[model samples]
Target: MLLESLSPLSGMINLVLVLLSVLTSAFTAAVGVGGGVLMIMALAQVMPAAALIPVHGMVQLGSNVGRTAMTWRHVNRAMLAAFLPGVVLGALAAAWLLVRLPAGVLELSIAAFVLFTCWGPGLPKRALGRGGILIVGAVTTLLSSLVGASGPVVAAFIKQSQEGRLAKVATFSACMLLQHLSKAFVFGVAGFVFRDWLPLMLVMVAAGFVGTWLGLRLLHWLPEHRFDNLFKWALTLLALRLVWLGGQRLAGAG
Candidate 1:
């Protein structure tokens, strides 16, 4: 019963998930974003439905921590400083409310958000003050607790604030790391048992570290314009997939 609860899949499917983790992490590392969404999408196909958010959160927490550590010098300390207060407020609110999403709502909402961040008229480039950053942080953190990955939202805000690619990636990774941290804490407070899947998560995180290393190497060779185009296309495809998944689930229920 313990094994069944922890790993609903056969050994082969577990191997596939670990491989997916590596590829997804590397992809995120190279393009400076989109890996966590990809990983969760794939995980949803294999893992038990109940474990999706918490397991994904832990895997991304490890992966982003790796990316942030590798590029710590480029992180925007001022921005993170402003974001922390909002994260605290958001986590507290999420824990207190204990909001459980209806089946299709979370996926569809994430799809819409990803599309907007990828293609919609972006937020103005003006640097947000502390208060603005705080609000953004709170909103993203709150949403992330529900959906599992808020990388696109965090990326959009970080893109507006930072000028260079390295700065953007570094700071964005830092912000996500913190968001995952908040999520883990919230789940713990809410009585989600994270230890059930610790073994699989550790293996996936190790694979993600390798992927992040390879992705960083590729990041240097890829031209900026080329990377931008690839990033946009990848995000669009993922968003479409999410929309389809949500629609199918809703249709089945109706």
Candidate 2:
């Protein structure tokens, strides 16, 4: 009967993903990064390949919106101005090219990019002025479409501005919320029906809000140095798994 239903996933797997969404949200809230990527990695295991990005985008949109609401006062308005236009441009471009990517390529590319962001060489420390931030917005948003989550990339850009932790987290959440909103709009206009997934997505989002609250509390107790190390190591291991899985898929396709 589980298999006979019209649900996008079996009841068991759906329940598991809902739980994982909470846990992952907590992880990111505590560490200031990694939750979205981790959630996508888990979803990739059971979600149909074609539905992955859009569904992931919607969930992240909700997650980040919740975070943005919590940290609204800390957001950087100036940076937001520079970043939004690029988001629109990037979303439009992605909408036009929304052809289904080969699953192997999509997975492998995301894995490689995640690893690069986690362990890759640091970008030059120069301040990217308005024009520069705009460019960062465009480029990273474009990459986000392919990879589903590019928090690290956007965070790196925000870091360059040398904002303190609260501003950094708040601004990052605001930027991502806008970007994800743009992505969702593009997907909708592109004719991807999202109605069926709405029920599950709403549940995951409610769970994510709970996780975010708990994670923020945990963050108050966690030292930055230890959290950073743990976050990177965890993401690195996940990336390696993605690489292996992606490679296997590619080989099978060949």
Candidate 3:
């Protein structure tokens, strides 16, 4: 009965996505970022483009919520407070526009920014504070609404901070939670019927929680230096892939 309800997906596909949710959630929880990007890339292969962003946003919303709950004690309250207003503004702006940008252009722009954040000169201390966070919040949230996964961009911005590993993971989860929440609202208003996907999303979210728990355990065992290197290289590789994909898309369009 339940299997019958998850239309447009065979039972095997549903099982695959559920397992993917677990793996990706664990990846993000331990490594601090890139999981959502990976998950969306996988989903894009199977899901219709029209349903892709909203469905992925819903699943990520659950994954982030689970991570945030588990690591709530380590979250940076000050940064989150400063980021809220920007989230509101960004969501509102996205709602007003309601137009999808060219895929290649958005992909290239995001990849460039992620690479720059990973390797470019660090921002001054002041720029890493409230004002900078506010801008990051607005811009990344806006981008997420269109792109389906802005976790790497958000993680890259947070990477500039001097917080310890746990705090960084916690804060990134919190920020992504808010971003995905805004995405839910925007897509809801845009007339995306989320009910159709609710059952699968719920199962995926449950699997994600289990993955988050295991990943947090791994996070504790990893050394700070190793974590830093892993995080950086993971993001760099993902960004480079985006660059390649974006170039291919542009060539095809041309």
Candidate 4:
């Protein structure tokens, strides 16, 4: 009797998670930050720690890749030319950073990146030189891997590029798609369980399709300058929460 009662509750909980996943994707699409960060909390609450981050990485990657593909032409190619090489450097750094440092440190650093992203009004009105953009890309991606929240950081750079809203989303999405791919490789080498995650992956990817489709339609409707500010603020809170979680873990380790 006890088991059966809990079983019904368990099913309800899972149904809620599935719905939440869809909304999370939609939220990020609308505001320009935080699909994975929200999903992290949801997954951790329901699953073992071992499966939480890495599994979430896979789902997030698929979503970002699809969004980028949808907005491919709008991406600022000049900025990408400056930024993508540094992403490769950042990816190479992920192997060392992921294992040697504590998760708490990574989380805190990532939160800090979001805070930086939040501080600005929405990218510098002043133009960054090509070299500056490249440096920003490498450092941001490196920090993102160490800190583990690449979206806001990437968004900030895209905003700084002043690529306009359409290009902002597209360029940010493309950069993130690459960044996540790097992180995925690192996790794969770390040997997290992927086979068991196939179903969840399918669900998140499908949600991404819906979210991106709706978000693109909505993007046309958003007023200029407003969404950028909103995106930064949203990223700030998400970053702080990750840092707090990391700090707690580090405290426990000590």
Top lDDT prediction, candidate number:
3
- Give lDDT for model 3: 0.88
Candidates in order have lDDT scores of: 0.80, 0.76, 0.88, 0.69
Could you give candidate 1's per-residue lDDT for residues 1-254 as a string of tens digits?
A: 43233354677777888888889889888887788887887888877777888899889999999899988999999999999999988888888886766667776887786687677786654437788789888978988887765677677666656766678778988988888899888889878887778878888889999998999899878887787777667667777777887888888777
Candidate 3 C-alpha lDDT tens digits along 1-254: 66656646777788889999999999999999888988899899988898899989989999999999999999999889988988998899888786676758878888898898889987778878888889889888888897775788888888987468899899999999999999888998899888878888899999999999989999999999989988999889988988998999998888
Ranking under lDDT, best-scoring first? 3, 1, 2, 4
By TM-score rank, best first, the candidates go: 3, 1, 2, 4
Once all C-alphas are superposed, what RMSD does model 1 give against the true structure? 3.3
Q: Could you tell which candidate, 1 or 3, scores higher by lDDT?
A: 3
Q: State every prediction's TM-score relative to the real structure.
A: 0.85, 0.81, 0.95, 0.78
Scored against the true structure, residue 206 in model 1 reaches a CA lDDT of: 91
Off by over 4 Å in 3: 99-103
Alpha-carbon deviation at 43 in model 1, angstroms: 1.5
Residue 92 shift from truth in candidate 3, angstroms: 0.7
Which pairs of residues collide in candidate 4?
A: 110-147
